[model samples]
Target: DIKPIEQLNINNLINKRNFRGIFGTQPPLSILEEIDYIIVSPGVPFDIPIILKAIEENIEVISEIELSYRLSNGKIIAITGTNGKTTTTSMVGEIFKESRKDSYAVGNIGLPMISKIDYSTNETSFIVEVSSFQLEGIKEFHPHISAVLNITPDHLNRHKTMENYIDQKSRVFLNQTPNDITILNKDNPITFSFKDKTPGKVILFSRLSTLEKGVFIEDNQIIIRNEEKERLLVCPVSDIKILGGHNLENALAAVAISYYAGIPIQSIRKALKKFKGVAHRIERVDIISGVEFINDSKGTNPESSIKAIEAMEKPIILIAGGMDKGSDLSEFVLSFKNKVRYLILLGETANIIENLARGQGINNIKKVASMEEAVLFSFNIANKGDVVLLSPGCASWDMYSSYEERGNIFKSLVKDLRR
Candidate 1:
């Protein structure tokens, strides 16, 4: 059965298209008797009774990404990580577009891989942002260049363990060969460990240290090294406008993916200089009474929120807490010390965050009931040189349909707030 079960919005299809809905804890075995194979969405748990039953019966299972890989004619550049996937994928798409190549940034960045299949050609490039959920269903799906930006503790509710999550992310490299390129993060230990498991020639990107044969920052300049001992200076670090060290890693990954995909260094540099970053990702909303309002509702995990917090230059009035993802929030709370002046919380995990914040000696906390209330509360307490940030450390599903909706509401609320 669907976990929430209320997302069954198939009424139009059911009434006009004769579609059927069948689900239960244990659906009839007869249902699987005629099924040749099963294609499960990433949201469907593998441990479900029907899925386990199908496996026991020797039925094949694959994911949408696998299906798209089999059907599409384009080269794929798959990106996966706990964070930075969207920004990196978007940046790669812009780079390809700047180089005048046909590209579509699909998958977990909001567009479905299957929906864009008809638009693809041999010359087309698919810049896909994959997730552990989607990767769990992949079998033979492989990208020409697979980049794992970084892996941290996330989605523990479904995977239940860090190793399983890492294994799922590693599936992006399953079918690559020596001719393909795999880009990884040299700073994150988890993603750096994936180098040994990759079947292809591995390149790396780092914000922390220079690399012998990959993309890295050295002397405030982005550089790429080749096996021939050749080094190409890409751009200066100040050329990138995206905030945070995490975003620097994203930019590095995008550069590696785009450069290997045959985009000229000049085109990639032009795109990097103009790209301001994606929406709801540390996006600056407005300045009201000298307080900068920032929307980072897409920071749906503690690790992502920590990056947003670290990026702040001023004392922050942070708006956090949303649907719990079973993450250990102690670190999320601990990151608040020294930077955050006031913590305004809402949604399901507000109380949990309050307790955790108290334990960390962060006492300036306020609990509100709605996004509007949270914004007003933060506005009332914020001063000049303070930032009002909406960087929830949990998913938005508790009070909104998606993070985009949550971020939109926050932006609107901040826009309408009286001075």
Candidate 2:
């Protein structure tokens, strides 16, 4: 019999004396006895009770990412982090294309890796954007080059603790042997601390210091070095289309991976120079009445939003807030005082953000009900030489499908206003 868990509906409930049960609640005691394996989605938190019960019954539980990784045959370049995974993954894929290699980009960036299984061939290399949730259930999933970009406090609601989240992300290297390459952020405290834990060959990428075996920025030029030799005068960080220090770090990581993957330095430089950053990531929409409108809807955490704010040179009419993901707003408070001239809050987390801003002595905070309201409010508040930035520091699920949807809506509204 087939049964649906939670709100899912089951088509087949019972058959003859076999006796199957469809459960809206937790699986009944009888049904639990017959179950063999359980596939959990990222939305479902890893519960100790369920795991303990599964162990007691000798049943195996796995995640969808694990299943895809197991079935995948192509060489995988897996990228994981709190932010910049999608942009870096896309950049790496573009580099492969520029080098005339057959490549497919998949995983958490949008396309499910499993869906592209038929597209795979002996020549295809998969550039996968993985999340901590996806990393949790791997058994034998190993990438040719796996990168842990940077880990900040994110998804605390789902992971329940920072340690748990870090553990989940560390699984990307669980099955990796010494031959496999692990690209890590040398500047990130959390990722840097894992140098001793990783079994694979660790390659460091940094913007802070010069690295002997990875990519680093020194004198405005990106320098890439491996054990055998070094490649210098790569490109200027200023020439990169993507804004902010965070993106530079991302580019460094992507460059390190592409170079190690056998893509020529010329091809890598061409791709980096030509690549306009991913959408919803500091994408400039239009200039309205001398005010610059920017969309950073992908900033769904405090750290990301803080980075966005720091990237702004002019005074900002900042649009922020959504469904709270348990990130502290204290970091943004000082940024608001320094960079933001006005603050517009929207969605479920608006009041909380407003309160936080108010407590920080920021009097320019305004709470709005919808994205349109926030946009209009920002337009009214913004002046010549100022920026109207949508860098909501929380999830968009409270009012939109995803951060992409939120960004699209912001763009559409700005276009309508312009017309």
TM-score of each candidate? 0.95, 0.91
Model 2 RMSD, rounded to 1 decimal: 4.0
By summed lDDT, the worst window of 10 consecutive residues in model 1 runs over 1-10
Give the per-residue lDDT of model 1 (tens digit) for 329-389: 9999989989999999998999999998988888999999999899888888889989999
Please write out the lDDT profile of model 2 over residues 284-362, one tens digit for every residue: 9999899999999999998888999988889999999988778777786667877889999888888888888888888
Per-candidate Cα lDDT values, in order, are 0.91, 0.85
Best by lDDT: 1
TM-score for candidate 1, residues paired by index: 0.95
Error of 2 at 204 (Å): 0.6
> What would the TM-score be for candidate 2 when compared with the true structure?
0.91
